[model samples]
Target: MNWQSIKEQLITFLKDEVKKTGLTKVTVGLSGGLDSAVVSVLCKEAFGENLKCVLLPSQYSSDGSIEHAKEVCEKFDISYEIVEIAPLVNAYLPNMEHNKLRIGNFSARMRMSVLYDISARDSSLVVGTSNKSELLLGYGTIFGDIACAINPIGELYKSDEFDFARFLEIPESILNKKPSADLWEGQSDEEELGYSYKELDDALKLLVDEKRTKEDLVKFGFNSELIELIDYRIKSNAFKGKLPTIAKIQWS
Candidate 1:
């Protein structure tokens, strides 16, 4: 997939976009996941010493997550900060029982809130790490993981990210781990989505990039229900991918 060319272009994109903002520094929420890991590498290549990664973990975050995130920062020699979000989450959601989804989403938002604040304090832009696969599937929380001043990896699919990640020599431990948002204990992207990234990426490539119809996808041997679910997710969460709606006034 010409990863070399793609990597070069992404680095250039990050540099150019941040330049437009008149900011020399940038921040990323490094979660020890594939997408964030790859984005951190790209940012390190682009911003070098100007980049700072913030590790915002909550009570639900596993110890391995913090270790994995720190590995990326130390290995790359990138500056990083660790901030726990459990206190913030517990302060507000103390009684919000059993609804792990709500807890997870709130945790994501809290992390982002801290990230944006850090970026402001450091005079840096927030770099987004969401991949095309997750964005298309509406797998991220709005104003949370999905928010960023610039996204270098937004176009790359999750499956393709593995290749790019390998190209950049991300830690094998990170590359080998299952995809998770790390919002709660035992949370998994595939388990919740009911499909592996490869399966989802292949279908999205056909449906979005190739603009194939659901019927055509079925003919192409995709499960009808899978195709249906994909279409529904894209339509339902389409708002998350866009700017907020505004009411128009007709005063000429």
Candidate 2:
């Protein structure tokens, strides 16, 4: 994937975004997961010590996730703060159904809130950590993990993320851990999505990037129902990938 070139582009991208925003620093929510760790490294390389990592752990967040996040910060020699969001999430969601999705979404929103608050205080832009796979699948909350003034890894697929991560020398534990949003206990990303990345990426590549129709997908051994579901998600979640739509009254 020409990681060296990708890294160069990413560094330049961050620098341009920083200059565009007129911000001297960047703040990011570190989930102690592969995506965030890779992003944190990119931000560090781009802005050096001007990057701040905020580890916002909620009640569903595992100890391993928190520890891994701290370890990445220490290894990268970047500044970080561990903020517990269980209290705030709980306050808003108390007596709410123990819906893992709800809890996880709330956690994401709260963490972004903290990061944005810090970014405002420091005059820094918020760097997003969501990878392309999640973005494609509508797997992230709209204003939560999806919110970013700049995102360095949003274009790389989950598979490409792993390759780039290896080149960047991220920790083995994080690289090897099962991917999750930590929205609820025992929730694995693949399990929720009902397919492995190998399958999902292949389908997505054929469907979205290659413009394959359902008939084309079925010939490729994709179940029609699953193909239909993915097609719906892609169509329905188009809003997530776009800026708020504007109505032009007289410009034309």
Candidate 3:
């Protein structure tokens, strides 16, 4: 995929986008995962000392996640801050009958809320870490991890994100770990999605990028069940990729 060339372009995009916003600095929520790590390195290359990595861990965050986030910051010699959002989340959703998904979504929003506030305080923009696969399938929390001023990796698939992360020499610990939002203990992204990113990304390429039909996908030996699931996800979650819909009314 010519990761080196792509990486250079993303770095340029980051720098140019931040400048367009009249902001010289950027803040990212480092989740101790491949996507955030890749974005961190790219922003570091783009903004140098102007990039700030904020680790917003909730109660569900793993200890290893926090440590790995710190390692990335230290490895890149980038500025960082650790803000615990558990207290804030608890205060907001206390005494509620929320399930894992609900609590997880709330936590995601809380973390993003902190990131935006930090961006305002630091006079920086929020650089997103969501990859194309997640965005395509609507696998992220709306107005949460999906919120950002500029997304350098949103166009790359999950598999491509890992490839780019490795090219950037992200810590092996992060690259090797199972992908997760760290929304709760014992939670894994693939487990929740019921498919590995490789499988999903492969299908996505055929369906979205190549504009293949269901019949064509079946001819390619793709499972009908998986195809339907992926198709539904793409259609249903398409809203996550667009602006809010508004109805137009005739004026007198």
Candidate 4:
């Protein structure tokens, strides 16, 4: 919330993370969305010119998103590259059965794969762009955008993330734009989730983080059926947050 203090801490946080991983630079996938924009700026403040922004776009990616990503990178003097993943994704689609969900998942994974490749080439860690709202609501792909060497904004909610964006003085264009994963054409994150962030975060605060039950949520003005639905989603997707489960045997 405090820009002065958060700025100081972020610089130190990024420095420590880079040191721990023995990387002098950091890379982030800039989606032209608020979360990635915030991450890019934070990494810039921390790592300076050592931060690189990669725009891994596919056919579903909008031109507006790409231009905005480039604009932000230029503003901060961070190096950037726009890599089109459409060809790569299309090349692989033929060999695999394709569906909307499958293609969406593939898009996420392909973006990650490109990021890791660049990370290895540049000796930088891939910085994550997920926020608390997305993480708690199971709104991200497991090993895709969800994967990162270190995340500075993952703890902030979608609303809180926008607060930090203002603190970092992000461009209004990015700030005011709709939130999207850009995995498919014309897909907005909120539209897909069937709720706005304001509503979702409020519910998540009571339901997931606060450990409230359906009745408790109903008391807090949430619909009983909706609470149950959210509860089911969170529990069912809990596996995504954990490392692969392993079977254990009784030991002597």
Candidate 5:
């Protein structure tokens, strides 16, 4: 996929985007996943010491995930801070039912809140970590992980992240690990999507990039149900990518 070329382009994109914002620094949420690992390296290369990595872990976050997040920061020599969010989450969850899905979504929003606050404190932008696969499948919390001032990796699919992350010299421990949001205990991305990223990304490319129809997908030996499933996700979750709607009013 010519990852080296894309790497250079993304770095340049990061620099240019931040420059346009008159901000020299950016804060990224490192989730100990392939996407964040790759984005952190890119931000580090682009902004150097100006890059800040915030580790927002809750009780559901695994020991390995925390260690992996710290590993990336240490390996890259990037500046970072760990913010434990158990208290904040616990403070609110006591009033609601203890549903993992709800808790996970709430955790994601809380993480985003902290990231934005850090960015405000440092006068930096929030660089998002969601890849194309997740974005397309609507696999993220609105106004949460999807929120960012600029994203260098948004267009890169999850399927390509492993190879791209490896090219970026991401830790093998991170690259080899299964993809999870660490939102709740034992929450897996693929499991939630009901399909592996490769399966999803491949179909997404055909469905989104190639503009192929369901009939064509079926002709290519792709199951109609999988195509339909992907289609529904794209249609349903499409709202996550947009800004809030504002009604027009003439006051003059």
Candidate 6:
């Protein structure tokens, strides 16, 4: 995919966007996942010492995730801070039943809140790590992982992200680990979605990028059920990708 060329373009994009915003620094939530790791590397290249990587680990975050995130910061020589969000999350949902989805969404939002606050404190813009696959499928929490000042990887699909991460020399541990939001123990992105990223990305390329119809997908050897499910997710979660709707009032 000409990753070197793409990498140069992305680094340039980050720098130009930050300049346009009149911001001198960039902040990112380093999740130790491929997506965030790639963004961190790009931000490091673009901002150099001006990049601030923050680790907002919740109670559910695994030790391995935190360690991996720190490894990226150390490897890149980027400045970072770890802000534990467990206290805040626990205070908010002390007695609630343990719901994986609910807790995960809340954790995402809390982490973002920490990032935005850090951005303000550091006078830096928040860089997003969400890839095109998640955005298209509405697989992220609204006002959470989806929130950012600028997204360098939002247009790259998950599979493309993996390639880019490797090209950027992200730690093999991060690149090889199962993709997760780390919202809970034993949580995996593919397991939750019921499809591997490679499978989903292939279908998405046909369905969204190539604008293929369901019949065309089936003709291309895609299962009807999978196509239907993906199409439904895209349609249903469309709201997450858009600004809030406002009612138009007629003047008297």
Per-prediction TM-score to the true structure, in the order listed: 0.98, 0.94, 0.98, 0.93, 0.97, 0.98
Give me the candidate number with maximum lDDT.
Answer: 1
Q: What digit string (tens of lDDT, one per residue) describes model 4 on residues 27-101?
A: 999988899988888888788889889998898788788988988988888899988999989987876676767
Q: What value of lDDT does candidate 3 attain over all alpha carbons? A: 0.91
> Candidate 5, 87: how far from true, in Å?
0.6
Query: Would you give me the overall lDDT of model 5?
Result: 0.90
Winner on TM-score between 2 and 5 is: 5
Tell me the whole-model lDDT of each prediction, alpha carbons only.
Answer: 0.93, 0.87, 0.91, 0.84, 0.90, 0.92
Please give the distance, in angstroms, between residue 201's alpha carbon in candidate 5 and its true position after superposition: 0.8
> Candidate 4 local accuracy as lDDT?
0.84
lDDT for predicted candidate 6 compared with the true structure: 0.92
Clashing pairs in 1: none
Clashing residue pairs in candidate 2, if any? Answer: none
Pairwise lDDT winner, candidates 4 and 5: 5
Backbone clash total for model 6 is 0
lDDT of 6 at 203: 98
- Per-candidate Cα RMSD to the true structure, in Å, reads 0.9, 1.9, 1.0, 1.8, 1.2, 0.9
Model 2 reaches what TM-score against the true structure?
0.94
Residue pairs of candidate 5 with colliding backbone atoms: none
Hey, what RMSD does candidate 3 come out at? Answer: 1.0
Ranking according to TM-score, highest score first: 1, 6, 3, 5, 2, 4
> What's the number of clashes in each of the models?
0, 0, 0, 0, 0, 0
Cα lDDT of model 5 by residue, 153-250, tens digit: 88888988888888889999998888999988788888887889998888888888999888889999887788999989889988899888899999
- List pairs with backbone clashes in candidate 4: none
Overall local distance difference test of candidate 2: 0.87
